[model samples]
Target: MCSRDLKTPWIDLNTLMRGQRRVLLRHGERPYQLSITRRGRLILTAADQDTDTAAAAAPPGKARS
Candidate 1:
């Protein structure tokens, strides 16, 4: 591996979260949620990809009957 590839990639949580309570991260076909809990701690967990994607794909204030 090149020396550049050996370096660790890192970012500050505050910069990443950016005042948001949660952010969705995609890993290939899978989706994961990164969130700040009420206690100010971080949590990472698998999200329901199908449901989340569908909801996001939906238009604002629109719903399927």
Candidate 2:
């Protein structure tokens, strides 16, 4: 199984396909979004507790189609 640092949230790249909306996981009672770009890059985002700008997790894999 893939494991991640508990210090940060993890989003699976394969799960984020273009034009989808779903909750991948939760952090401290808040949900995060997993999505893909038209270019097929996977994305992970969480609301920054200190600001409106979303805090993004690192992409999980090497850029691949």
| Top of the candidates by TM-score | 1
Give candidates' CA RMSD values in order. Answer: 7.8, 10.7
- Report the Cα lDDT for residue 64, model 2: 19
Per-model TM-score, in order, reads: 0.61, 0.34
Model 2 ranges off by over 4 Å? 1-24, 47-65
Q: How far does residue 61 in candidate 1 sit from its true spot (Å)?
A: 22
What is each predicted model's overall lDDT from 0 to 1? Answer: 0.66, 0.46
What lDDT tens digits, residue by residue, belong to model 1 across residues 1-65?
Answer: 44666467868998886666676778899888776766788778786845464443343334523
lDDT per residue (tens digit) for residues 1-65 in model 2: 36666877665544443334322445777766555555765466763344221223334432312
Backbone clash pairs in model 2 (N, Cα, C under 3 Å; residues 3+ apart or in different chains), count:
0
Candidate 2 TM-score to native: 0.34
